[model samples]
Target: MFPLSLLFGFYFVQFSSAFFGTGGIFGHVLRYQKLCLCRCGVSGVTQFPDSFSNVRLLDGQSVSPHQFPWLASIKIDNRTIAGALISDKHVLTAASPLYGIPPNRVSVTLGLHDGCTRNPALSSSIETVILHSAYVSGYSYNDIALLRLRHVVPFSQFISPICMPDFRTLESDQVASTLSWKWAPNSVSCTPRVATLPILPVWTCLLNRNSDTITPNKGCLGPLGIKSIVCEDDVGAPVMSRQPYSSSFRLVGVVTTANCDHTSAPYYTKVAYHAAWIYEQIRDDCQCFSI
Candidate 1:
């Protein structure tokens, strides 16, 4: 087994640099997610501390600005969507924001927590917005997209990429974490809140959705109590999780639709289902393929 120091060092530097800088061990996303499959594997190692405990104490509890450095905020024309920083130059988000719209108008801001104060953070021109090819128009399946930044985003306490889960090992019972930002009442600024919720059983009413256009590319979260139902404004927000015995948090889902009243469960685009597609887009764009 590699020393803890070696693993931690790899967590921050190697994982980011090699994957983004073309140094070493950069493989497909799904395989990367399977790194923890071995009980005593190197991927079984973890880096960061848990943001909080397993309990879902409150719905909109205030989150410290420095937490969840991978948080991303995207703006297109007049609309705003939440995103997760998956890599140095890549941001993962919901494709619903891009449906029927051109990618040229999008811009992403990293490291910013409070928009009202115009607090310090990073911003970049979006080089390209790649939407999932299987995404259906006006529906929830495959509701994912990627934004390629013009340059790499430097890592900092307030900014870093979220870890990718080992898809091979994640169980349905995995705990899910999500952060929500609501526009201040009658104001333009947003206040960030954290919510912990349950993932619906693999077979749910939503899975039997009547729409022929809907695909099996999404997951359902909650039947959360009335006060905690995800609202319309939270669309595109990330639903994240930490693997057993690992401190790294990974993107699990992206909010597609939520009733906000807790009656109907909210739907999210399943990140695992698109792991292959994600690796392809990033690898091809980075031109990381070898001869």
Candidate 2:
């Protein structure tokens, strides 16, 4: 844990000195770094408090700016998909979005509140796309992928990485939520939104759906009520759970199938099940700090 704090502190000083100078913001960064070490877990600190309880992504409310700093947008072939920042240089997303797309055609945007515009200062190009070896096209099994950025991301008030869940500590009935962005009606831009999604037992999911297609590697979420609408842009969005007794949030799932229609329960690649694969790829540079 001390090493993680030092890792964050080094980056804060480096980024702040390069961009914000050595006096005011530098001192502020130092103080904030200490605050992070003393109070908040290094990975999941946000600028604002969580107010996303009971909200729905498609039929839910909008999120405040910097509310979920780890949320990121992946733009590929002119289409936008949601992703979660898992480290300084990697993003966790659904492999479906990059099924046939090349890394050269994909770009990542962090510190975003609107989905319609791309902020050049906050965007990065993909250096590599690591999809799970078992990932199959058109199926939800092994649907996770990691996008390695060409540059290191600087954490700030509106940009940060999320904590990875300790699979060993996960519970079947823990409350979860999905975060995504959708085009506003009659508007040119899109806004970020969140919704409550309860995790369903794997046995219950298997009994209710295509038993042959669904696997234990996936987690079932929601009943997408009658009013819910399909959220295509949410394909690579994150399904997260708040750390008990802490203000931090951890990645629990990566959305693969998102449909808001009645009787449709979006399925996500369970992060717990793939903890080995994910850690193997990022263990050198990323660490999950348990609160």
Candidate 3:
């Protein structure tokens, strides 16, 4: 097997050239390696699982808030990585796996139900993959990237854009309450002669703001609980939110990094902190939608 560092370097070189339009030795190498282009496999469809199912391969289904067929599948060469669609042209994914890679070399496939069958007529291909400029390995900050496809994905029940959150309105306490709260207090409890104060919930720390020396960057995580964000196959996946009255989903976090093997915790980039940067990138690179 190739050294992990070397593999990363190789990927970076290939990614930079394709996305940046820079061409040279690394580009040639990527071209020769066929790393610059990829196709979806028939087996790629098996990758999707119902979110509620206990079985890893065939669980229940994707959660409702994220229940669009377009929000799925990352393709590189013949290999396919899992991804989620956030916009007409952008697919969100883990930064660690995609850092230093080129956008053209990566193609995101959407609207597919299974990988075992090939249906070019039904699937759509994205135009490019844009890695967050500030992404760094081993750090949760800026762990997300957007894949921009050549064409706009039409809106449908199976294919649609997610509602990004208004970062300006997000509060730390609100986040805490949402992730930790179980049930609201009963209405009659306050009127009773003997009523207990609502319990202040405790949260598991998902990101340690102080643990790693890296200053909190655009995509880094602070302290959070395990339930706040769990480890999943697709890194760079967006953590979206939709309140009861909300009309659309809003991005709250992104999968920055995780050590599933550690059995300790998973970390995510706080979307609120980097909302501006995210919008900037989308504005500069994506033509399918307006920022």
Candidate 4:
């Protein structure tokens, strides 16, 4: 099995060169892989249990293993951060974790509800790290990123991808949430936390200092008061929302920047705005993923 990945690694190198010559989707692939390409199963519409039989959330961590299957963890620099499994081959997160860490040092672990406590069976190696083209050193608006796994994650009761939202379905003043694990003040263990916040108008997020960077592509999680909900290590937490009639939760934004003050809503990069860029990374056109 390892040899199979290595075999593709060779072809990936060749195809990547040809991809560079084309300079279209190839550029997106180039930006994502950062010279090293990896994979898991390419793509598929997966089935997940709408109702978890034995799952609960205490703070920001799930009580059972399969409670929140789409919630995954990115491990780098001996620190584990939150992320969401958007597909079998891709996990969505903020650009902060990958900023200074070496790509090879990162891995995404799925199917485990308690990310802070134990190692899970379903882990994928990092293949590529793609940050938004407009991302800068300190600015956080365009902070969304994709991590392509080196191997396919077998979908199971304990592992699945979250739903991707269509902009048309997200009406104004919709309720969205952040599902993550947090370490509280003076607490030894982290617990699963859930904080549902209203999707504020983009204009509201722009009223702050340096708010000119606010665009339709960003989301604000304030106006709901959540200082008691979010934790210091909860960055990259998925901003999720359930469709009106759907049981499964879809990913809407990522925890890019947040405030310890509930008075101030945190900032997240709206996933809908980058829908096109995201599709380009996971789509079959790249020839980077194999089932």
Candidate 5:
């Protein structure tokens, strides 16, 4: 295994240099140079489908009306940015898109079927946008930002929140599998034996470590050691997990970065990690509205 100190050193160098916007020099090195840096690998239970209807555009259709029930289009002074509804009062998105824009200049369009081709006049406007206190411009660390709508959206089968995973339920490899192996104390084993044991990695939901004491110019990347679902145009999308209580989904993660393209891995802000912060933001900024 590579030295942990070396791995951390490399990561810090890359992160710090990139933070300065040095023409993305560090990013280029990491992406193209094939640096064998040790990233925290989160092995766990999740399946990637062949296709997702939420992100894909329909064939022969410029806009997919009702493709995703809770999808929303965010507009700031006539310029549109991608966003999605994660809860009745919360809309999730990336911070970069709204960096310099004032709150009044931003408006969210809800209950929209076709945002790409529909006229702006056809959509309903949101009341307010509540940006995260630590949102930054260039770097996409704590890339998540929330929008608190003036009114609450009624819960419907088509429009419900996603479920979040429990952090307490997460177990490490040794604890998750109840198996043990023993070697003969006095015998030398020559033949190699490979055990075909399937081990699933534990996935823990986490939140911003310093959400309350955050600064406008500094967005925290992570607490470290978690799997992220980063995607492009995922800037303002909702990361949801299906729930068992009903056929509804629970809000788990928020779409944050476009750094991971179609060919690259995606990243998302873990919802379970920041549920308290999210609740606080919603309670403080939003008012319930009927559909």
Candidate 6:
């Protein structure tokens, strides 16, 4: 059984290169094996454990400090957007809000809880912004982007990358969650809130809405009564799924359109559908783990 599993892993690595354009078969395999062994064997680890213990089904609640180490705050000029750390030097986020913004004006902060008091030590200047080639301004389709940090982040109890899952792990109607940051009433600091949601089918997402707008690469979540699990602040947040019997969480989607009123379901760019693109872009630092 062990031998079979090992053989399968090798085949998966070789097979993925054809789809992801990783180049040179032997080099790709060696690079992937090294990445899996050295760089990100510890991805998705957390300092604060979240069992989603006794979580209410109706409302999202505040999470404890450092509960989500991969959460990233992308400050673009005066406003901020949520993002998820996927590697030492890369962050995954939505492309809509950043459509017209210049990459030079954007910066990212990790280990962030309160938005008002940003620790200078935890911030990094963005070196480049790579938007999905197919993404268009004012359009929801292909709304994904990657930000390369000028300086690599050192992993610690307070900071880490969320694991990027294999396509096999993505399934419909799975129990998932998202972490969002919203400003306090005083507008002095931001609070981190978490909510549990269920992934819905594309057909279900189009039931009450225009079917023409729902794309195959998009996925839906929520309609949780009147109050919603996601809001405007969650637009660029990561929809994550906790691995069974594991403390780690895998990024499943990137929020694109969230309706706070719960009148319609929220939508996200399906990470599984764009797995090859993501892997292709992050090839240099990519790491794969069993889903």
Model 4, 38-125: lDDT tens digits are 3322112254244332222234333444556677878886777789887768889998767866679998877665545665557778
Considering lDDT, where higher is better, how would the candidates rank from best to worst?
6, 2, 4, 1, 3, 5
Q: Model 4: residues >4 Å from true position, as ranges?
A: 1-64, 116-120, 183-191, 207-210, 224-228, 285-291
What does candidate 6's lDDT look like per residue over 87-124, in tens digits? 77889999988887887899998988776565443889
- Runs of candidate 5 exceeding 4 Å displacement: 1-67, 116-127, 154-231, 243-246, 259-263, 284-291
Residue 40, candidate 5: how far off, in angstroms? 32
| Model 5 TM-score, all chains together | 0.48
The list of candidate 1 runs beyond 4 A from truth reads 1-59, 168-171, 183-189, 205-215, 224-228, 284-291
Q: Determine which window of 10 residues in candidate 5 has minimal summed lDDT.
A: 174-183
Per-residue accuracy of model 3 over 150-220 as CA lDDT, tens digit each: 77666454455544555343423333111100111221111101000111112324134344533343333
| TM-score of every candidate relative to the true structure | 0.75, 0.78, 0.55, 0.72, 0.48, 0.80
Candidate 6 ranges with C-alpha deviation above 4 Å: 1-59, 119-121, 183-189, 224-227, 286-291
Model 3: residues >4 Å from true position, as ranges?
1-66, 118-126, 167-210, 213-232, 284-291
Give me the overall lDDT of model 2.
0.71
State the number of backbone clashes in model 1. Answer: 1
lDDT of 1 by residue, 70-112 (tens): 7788888987778888766788888887777665788889888
User: Model 1: clashing residue pairs?
Assistant: 33-166
**Considering every candidate listed, which one attains the maximal lDDT?**
6
lDDT of 2 at 252: 87
RMSD (Cα, Å) for all candidates, in order, is: 6.9, 8.5, 16.2, 8.1, 22.1, 5.0
lDDT of 4 at 132: 77
lDDT of each: 0.65, 0.71, 0.43, 0.66, 0.42, 0.73
Better of 3 and 6 by TM-score: 6
Best by TM-score: 6
Ranking by TM-score: 6, 2, 1, 4, 3, 5
